[model samples]
Target chain A: MKLIMNLMASILLSVPAFIASVHAETAVIVSLDNKNTYTSIDKELVARIFLAKVTKFPDGTTAKPVNLKQGHYLREGFNRDFLSKTESQLSRYWSRLRFSGKASLPKEVNTVEEMKLAVANDQSLIGYIDAMDVDDTIKVVHKY
Target chain B: MRIGSIIGSVLAAVLVTTTVQANSGDLNIYGFMSVGVGILDKNEVTIEDFEGEGNFKQDTVLGIQVSKQVNDNTTATGQLVSRGSSDFKTEAAWAFISYQTSTDLTARMGRLRIPFFYYSEFLEVGYAYNWVRLPSDVYNIPFSSFDGVDFTQRFSIGSLDNSIQVNYGRLNDELTIFDENYQSDLKNMAGISLTSTYGDWGFRIAGQRTEMTLDTEVDEAYVSAVQVATIAQMTHSANPTPQSGVDLQAAASALAEAEVVFVEQRRIDQGQTGAILLAQQMNLDLEVQDEFAFDGHVADFYNAAITFDNGNYSFIGEVTAIEYESGLLVDNRAWLASFAKRWGDTTTHLTYSTSRDVLNSGDSGKLQEALNLQGEDKSVTLGLRYDYDVNTALKVEAQYHDEIMNRGVEGDYAMLYSFAVDVIF
Candidate 1:
């Protein structure tokens, strides 16, 4: 009975860790300001923007994509939306693109506050933040 | 001619307009430029009467690329590249469209890269790769564009990080230079590659298949003229050296070797038909005003490449093969291995790499072919790179080339090097 209980406990402990890594990437929806007029962003377009593959938004407003420096929730959200690539993966990808003249690397801003401020200030700016970080100033386009 | 001029004018207009668009709202524009000086430390080798060492400033390049995003998921990219002296002339290096699927996968279509090896996609990005230049022998095929679709997917497998990519495409190109002629076609290319990582180490393995038809015509007279002209230039370039005359003689001899072989092949094609020989020679003479005229080259080509990487270090190698229908042997292979060590937070790295190409024996129709192969050629390079940040950086590189004469084309060894800086606006 004790062994069975221990086995159950161990299995339960491992599941979340496995699940977290496998699902570390999240799908996010983003927009210009807190208007919340559009609630969903196309999954593919999100990928294109983060990879610097896309230049326009759904409504063709010329979406300005902002990156949350290196270690912010919004940046992670953005990565998940566009490439699911981490900083290193991004580095390698850019290395290839830089050589071919396909695209340049994205702009980096270190803090979520900086991210929020930048996105809020620009009419075309789009950024990804955690669901909890969303406020009246930044509208939620999609959430994972 | 008028249509060509009109098209050229339109292209120029569009480029001017795009440059004006630079960065507006969702639009972002960025690119890079570089220039450098090179020298040959050694010239005039005399082991087997070789005379092509010690030339410099023959290795300079410049490039510019622009990209725009159409929507959240779809994007378009166009790149124009140039190398060698004179402000980087136009080289149709890269032009394509790409799409991303979620965060884990992306796809691209249009004039895509051949993806023959790990560096195939970035062969010209001397700033990105370690080598001063890829081995000319291994990457000898003159073509790198294709109409195809490429798909890349990234995900995890157990404790490993994995990415797999597959590409399919077709390509065709033609060339005409004096009397040497080449025509080619590559149809239906399908290839798959995979990259996996465990800890700081990563690895790649991939392969591809190609089918092609190639047609070629060579002008003996034009080739002879070009050889003589090139010899004259080399002699002028080598004037300061005492062995210049000897080098000239050796070059002339090599030309003779090629001539003897070419004429033999021509005679075979002529066979017993004197009328055929006279008619073909007349046509060839008209077609080849200078150098050698290129005939139509049609063929299907395929390639595969694999790579391995460790955070502070990496190595990538690839091999590409193609069969030509134009009775000429067009098979070649090249590989590059690199190792790098990085400094601290500032991001400085030093690396060394080498590339080589080996030519395979070709098929000769009825005509006795010299198979003018010396053996293989290789380029060894050492370089240093510094990245102040992702968008800005600098690189320096040097290379030494060793040549082998195949059946009979003059082969000369050279030493070349360069330094470059990259920036964004």
Candidate 2:
């Protein structure tokens, strides 16, 4: 009886914590050595950068935005909260722009770790990952 | 020429595959396809081949585009599109070199899509919009592309994102009107479009002017009408002549006693009332033929559109009008309104559209009725689009046309059902 009660308590206590982790805040990050002089960015600028509407950052440095692959959960959250677009909406938008030769899609990485590596290796690149994954090699510019 | 088209398509495919396989640097390749089958309950055709029987050749299309960054500020791009309606022949839809002067301005030269409508540039890309096909009432212009130079400037006003495009171009191609082919030439073409977006609302307006000419063949009905009228006039007039008086001058001179023959021959050639009054009574306008055939006439086109899109729901409305200085051709106006809602992976859309020709009061109006070119129709369509995957979609649509003007004949109400699978890579 005691053993069963302990298992039930543990599961009840950990379930909400697991749910919280899954819905954790997303952090938009830049390289520690990023050339552009900006401590933080607004959601509109982030949306513009990710959409490839603006090729340069506020300070006029060429900005290269990176994206996590299609099915990444953190990427989905970031797209919804920061860009205010759904995956399908973004897909259609990018299709029009890319096929018309007006703009190209941002470089896509397969995993959050790869996203971190890509942004850290290129000072011009900006990407996002889970807040818990933020590290010293990258600077968190915005959170949602 | 058919062999050349085949060879060109083969070469384009080979090049695309080789470049993609090699993973060439700074070279990007993309492709899209939509394979559709449609059938109508009525005997009249709607979209090229959607007649009484099921047809797959009208809406099926494939397109491939390639772009390379030529330098820091320039890019080279080319697109090839194949349509089943044309027996799967491939054509270069766009081939241009774009130079970015600034982050806000871009200039491109070469063959480009005519900026006549909001969706003109990506008209063939099925996945770009919500419809199985765009409404023909607003999109069935004879010309699609022109060899040209265009300047696009992007800026913002308040919270609205704005883009202004100015283009100068010319198109020389074969056009099919009334199921007959004519060599069409559009020169001195100039157009401008402005698009503005604020949050979920979008608006666009455009205008274009061009010098248009068509090499048209003489209508047999017109010839017969003139012949019958002339015979009736010569035989029953004050000074009667034989039925064989093919020579208008001789017949007119036979009426010399009436002093009408002294009128200038130039007046007859100009289609004045004296010589062709009987022809006009017979519902034939020889004047229109004299005014427009093989002669350059000025034309103007106008378009306006508004769109609203949120995550789950969207609405669009568009209107277009065309006018010609010489009223030989139909001056048409078209409009469409559409609403769509998304439920999970499926989107349901409802659309209503209509088009009609503006009839005038003179020889132009008689010509319009005589040729039976006064097109007037309306339709309503319901469709569902299912996103099977991130890059692929499946769509099914049913269109109910209250009236369909097919080749100048009014067709009764009919239902057209179609399905399409669209994909991009």
Candidate 3:
């Protein structure tokens, strides 16, 4: 009975830690060509860019923002941490802007691989992905 | 023949340009649709032709938008919407061409939304807002669109972001009041708005002014009174006798009696001359027309709003005031407060809204009654929204509306329940 009680306590303690590790660290990324022009970006600016409030990069070039498809875990993590908005909140925000003709929602890619490919192909493009997925083709501009 | 062929060639060229650009991935198509079923517990509250029992078509709508990038600096966009309130008639909601002058400035021209309220631009897009609908007391403006030019400028100061918009426009449309339609025109409509945001807080202030003209059916009593007054003046001018003065006073008193006679005569014979003779004897103005016209009227509106959001909790409050210089339109003040809490995929909100019209003792009885009817509505709404999918939400709401006044008299209250689905693609 003592051994079983001790085992149950350990399992219960590890459950929360395991769940916390399930949420991946998110990174805001740009094409390799934009690495020199945009080495690092502040969180505020990243939020604004993703929200379509700011449309241009620091170098004065038009910023094309891309996003992972809805329901993607990394995308939700990025929205929560960097944008400080939930998926539903962002959806409502984008709907308002999109319908009003004030701004357009970011283009969506189905997977991280597709997002990286899209960003790599366009110098002005910006997107976010799991930190583990960052490689040579894209530059990490911000991480959360 | 040459001119016709040249015009045809120009048309073909334009068509080709549109087709090629659309195929080049420079064009985007988007749309939203919302449908709802609502039931009023009692027939106490009425909106236009919708009242009594249950209604399925009152809140149904669909909108389609297309945008084309003409170049790096220019883009064209248009939206078409069909609403159940208009009997599912499709109309152009927006048709504008925007030019990006710089990173922080843009200019646009064409038919655009008149931003009288914070949600004016997306008012029809039900998926955008939290409520089942925006408070009708405040959002119920006669005109929603204008042909205009506008400039928008955006900037940031430290952690605060700001945007300013200025516009000038004109609108010519029909406005409906009490189930009667009037020809309405607004000229030289100009407005400015400023919005600021910092983290989870947002604030906005906007003001607008316009010169207005309206035409409506003349009241029978008013027409008769004016006719009698005119005839009295003519008789007095033609003959300066004491007997003529007495006759004029009698005619003025008989103006009310002449209404039945006028109606009877019109029914018997549409163009009988006997009625004119009777009206003339009563000192009526034979040249009176059937329509009442009001021109050179001025109207002004101002509004302010503040919002705060911290992911799990959100709150918004707004106030608006409208005034007419000529007293042709009722002056009104309205306010709304809303609070919401989000838990996972569900959000629950409560809202309170009220409106009152400022009545002037100096106004005519008829005008005062109309203004009173316009002034008094208060409502409390409870709503829940569930994100059923990535791009869809299911919402249910119940509103209790208390009518403070109806037709210059105290009125009763009502309750409404509604269920809706809002989707975007």
- lDDT agreement with native, every candidate: 0.54, 0.78, 0.78
Model 3 error, position B197 (Å): 1.6
Candidates in descending lDDT order = 3, 2, 1
| Candidate 1: tens digits of C-alpha lDDT, residues B1-425 | 99999999999999898877753645544454444444455555321121245323334555566667788778777766675532355665667778876555778887777666556777666545544455554654556767788888766554466668888987677632112334666667677877665543456666665565444344445355445746665775867365776666666777677656656544212221222233343433221111111133344344444455434445555555554433333334445555565553133333323322233332222111232322456566676666655555466666666665433455566665555654433
The lDDT of model 3 is 0.78
**Clash numbers, per candidate:** 51, 0, 3
DockQ of each: 0.16, 0.50, 0.50
| Candidate No. with top TM-score | 2
Q: Which ten residues in a row have the lowest lDDT in candidate 1 chain A?
A: A25-34
Chain A TM-scores for all candidates read 0.66, 0.82, 0.80
Ranking by TM-score: 2, 3, 1
Give model 1's docking category. incorrect
Report the candidate with higher TM-score, 1 versus 3.
3
TM-score of each predicted structure versus truth: 0.56, 0.82, 0.80
TM-score of 3: 0.80
Per-residue C-alpha lDDT of model 2 across residues B1-425, encoded as one tens digit per residue:
99999999999999999988688578888999999988888775554336778888888999999998899789999999998866787988899999987667999999988888878888889998888788877787777888889999987654567889999989898765544456889998899999887777889999998888876444333344445556656665756555444455544444453333323322122222222333455655456445534457888889999999877899999999998665556788999999999998899999999988886567666655555556777889999999888898899999987656643577577788989999998
Model 2 stretches astray by more than 4 angstroms:
A1-22, A32-40, A60-62, A121-124, B1-21, B44-49, B217-233, B236-290, B361-363, B404-409
